[model samples]
Target: MFGIYIHIPFCRKACHYCDFHFSTSLNYMDEMVDAICKEIALKADRVSGTAGSIYFGGGTPSILPATALQKIFQTLEKHFDIATGAEITLEANPDDLNAAALKTMRALPVNRFSIGVQSFFEEDLRWMNRAHHAGEAIDSIRRSQDAGFENLSIDLIYGYPLLSDEKWESNLATAISLQVPHLSSYSLTVEPRTALAAAIEKRKEPAPTDAQSAEQFRMLMARLQSARFEHYEISNFALPGQYAVHNTNYWRGVPYLGIGPSAHGFDGHTRYMNMASNATYMQALLRGQLAEERELLTDHDRYNEYVMTSLRTMWGLDPELVISRFGRSYHDYLHTALGKLGSNDWLISGDGKIKLTTEGKLYADHIASELFKVDEE
Candidate 1:
């Protein structure tokens, strides 16, 4: 099944840890919406068949008005075949999900809300420069549930300087208490050029420690698993049958259309990346042209991507599928690589698939990099 991802590149506030392409200014909201709709119509023919999921991600999709969202959906309806029960998700901040907002959202086709409630503590929220307070975070989820939007997820962050082990446990406890079906938790990474990184460089704030992050991640896993949540993906936990459909499709290499500035689309063999500049995206789309670059994947590139994404999921990478898709040579290469891993507690083979041990997950990126298929010099 195909999917579609729309990047709404505007935010009410710039979170300190975010380096995503977005503007705090709403000066061109109408124009950007128009451009997005135009981009959808323009790229309609690229992917065939019904869309199983449509995800609105980025700077804060909920920051847009219901009318703007409706207009975009109308354009999508006119151009694409969306399935009867498609999962349409909007990534929202807690501040935007007020009573009036959720009421208006009920009229739209959006069925899921991925609320960005980074923490349920006022100090933590302030540190991250998050748009909402602890109360707003709690209220927004209740309001969304009250408004009949039960399929919800919330984001939580750990490993920052202010987050002690006690506070980290409290964060997880609060999320579990909220009864949200899905949770996407991440460690605070100080990306270069972001405010967090800048502060650390100047010694204004201490950097997040790997030891702290790993400890918190373990706490997260144990707590959530005991709460009956499945650790489906490394950073995602969900109650039974409540996985994020769009992101799942992404991991499975399903073809999807990416609309709006800075969005990326993939169709098995190639990728389309839109220009990140808002003005450039709008200008190009207004002239009926796409401001995007295309990359055709090589076999090595495809294999590496597959290994990286598939290994992150609870469904481990299949060696048989590797043999069938990439031939005996690549399969042999994999066996050799597995030999190199050699009795490490990081990986386990069961049911003809190779999966990571829970502790191994902390070194997932390292392990995946080790397993990568590289080009011969």
Candidate 2:
């Protein structure tokens, strides 16, 4: 089934490492919400059937008040046939999940909360410029749980300068103790033009090292595996039956409608990217138009996308399906690439699927790139 994604582009504070399209100002909150609702109504006919998942992702979806969120939900229900028991997720920051906030969120259709608790230490939070402290991080989860929102996921970041191995272990242990069903963790990469990258260039902050990231990732896998969490995707761990429906739909190439500035939508064969500028996005919607660019995907694009995403999951890649869907030429190309990999212990092939070994995950990007069919037909 298709999915719906709404991008909330406002945040209270800008995290140092974030380069995602967002504004620290809330001046246009009402107008932005209006524009998002309008966009949703305007694009309602794009997806034919029911939506199985609705994800509210952003600079901080929790930054919006319940009224604004409720209005958006109203618009969605009006235009789309959202499936019964659809997984509705809101990505919230720790500091915004107070008692009043949690109460309001429960009033909406949101059944899942993905809290951005990047670390459990004050120093790490401060270093990353997170809006919440260590206490709020723990309290937010407990508060949300108390509010009867148990379908919860928390994000944790590793490979940053201040995150030691011992500290990483502590972070994992704390999350396990909280009994949250899902975890999405990632390495802190310094994206160009972000505050973190600028600091690194000026020698004000130490850059994250590859070796450190690799070692910590190993620790993450072992610890989570023992805790009965499935490493279903490269950076995602979840208890049984707790996988995130929205993100899983994304990886499996389920078509979705993305609403709001800097959001993206895909319909199997094409991609739509919204304008990153908030003003531009709102202006277009005000004029009853969408400020987005659409690209028709080539076979090359589809093949690479499938390989990149499917290889990172426990499901692995099926060569025969590739042959059936993308044609024999593409499958032949993949076979040739595999031969070139030679004696590398990074991949295992069985049951007509090729999957990455634990060591191979460290080089997931490299491996996918090597397997990519780059040239034209």
Candidate 3:
């Protein structure tokens, strides 16, 4: 089964930390939506049969007018066979999620809601320049739940200069109080050229530190696990049977089509990304072409990707699959590397699966890279 992701590259406000491709100007909104639809049609024939999930991710998917959302959905329906009861998700911000808007969203195929409630404190909200207030976050969540969209996930951010441990705990407490089924939390990072990065450089804002981030992350994991939430992925927690399907598909190497500017897609063998410019993307679609760059994966690239993605989850790498799928050479290499890594007590093995210990998870990317195959051919 395959999945679909449509990136809506428009937002009402620019968050300081965000580096995603988007425009705050609404001048090109109509043309942008039309271009997305045309691109959807242009790429529809390439999708594999049986779409298991559809995700409306963004710069703020909820910023689009209802008619625009419906038009894209209609386009998908005409071109692809979306599976019955597929997990359809929409990424929304709190300010845009009023009662009337939630009512309209329920009428569409969006079964899951991923609200961008980065923090529940007024100070944190202001620090990040998020579009919503603390009260708006809580109210929008309640309104969405009242509207009968129960499959919900909320995002929280920790490890910033202003987010004290007390505030982080309060954030998780708020999420729990709302009974949200899934939670996606991340440590605040300053991406290059973003406002946050510039502010830090100018001594306007304190930079994030590893020690504080690690401590808060540990608190987050412990609190959520005590509340019966599974730390299924490093940055994700979900109650039973409530994992984000589209994201999980990505982890398990399932194929997906990413629509809209700066979106990335993967078939079983190759990966591609659309151009990041709105004007360029729209012009290409208007001219009956896709401004995407493709990269064909070598076996080593695929193996390294598998190692990196799998190690980040609760389920670790499988030696048997490595041997069968990648070759005996990879199988032997995995064992040899495991021996070296085991000395550090970072990884634990049992029940025919290898997984990261609590300490190992902090450096998961480093561990995966250490086990990588760097040879060509």
Question: Which candidate order results from sorting by lDDT in descending order?
Answer: 2, 1, 3
RMSD of 2: 0.8
The lDDT values for all models are 0.94, 0.95, 0.91
Q: TM-score of the candidate numbered 3? A: 0.98
Instruction: Tell how far residue 251 is off in model 1, in angstroms.
Output: 0.7
CA error at residue 120 for candidate 1, angstroms: 0.5
Say which candidate scores most in lDDT.
2
Model 1 stretches with alpha carbons more than 4 Å out: none
Per-candidate clashes, comma-separated: 0, 0, 0
Angstrom error at residue 189, model 3: 0.9
lDDT per residue (tens digit) for residues 103-122 in model 3:
78877988999999999999
How far out, in Å, is residue 85 in model 2? 0.6
Runs in model 3 lying further than 4 Å from the true structure: none
Cα lDDT tens digits for candidate 1, 295-358? 9998899889989998999998999999888888888998998888778889988999999999
Clash pairs for candidate 3: none
Candidate 2, 136-221: lDDT as tens digits: 99999999999999999999999998998999999999999999999999999899999899999999988899999999999999
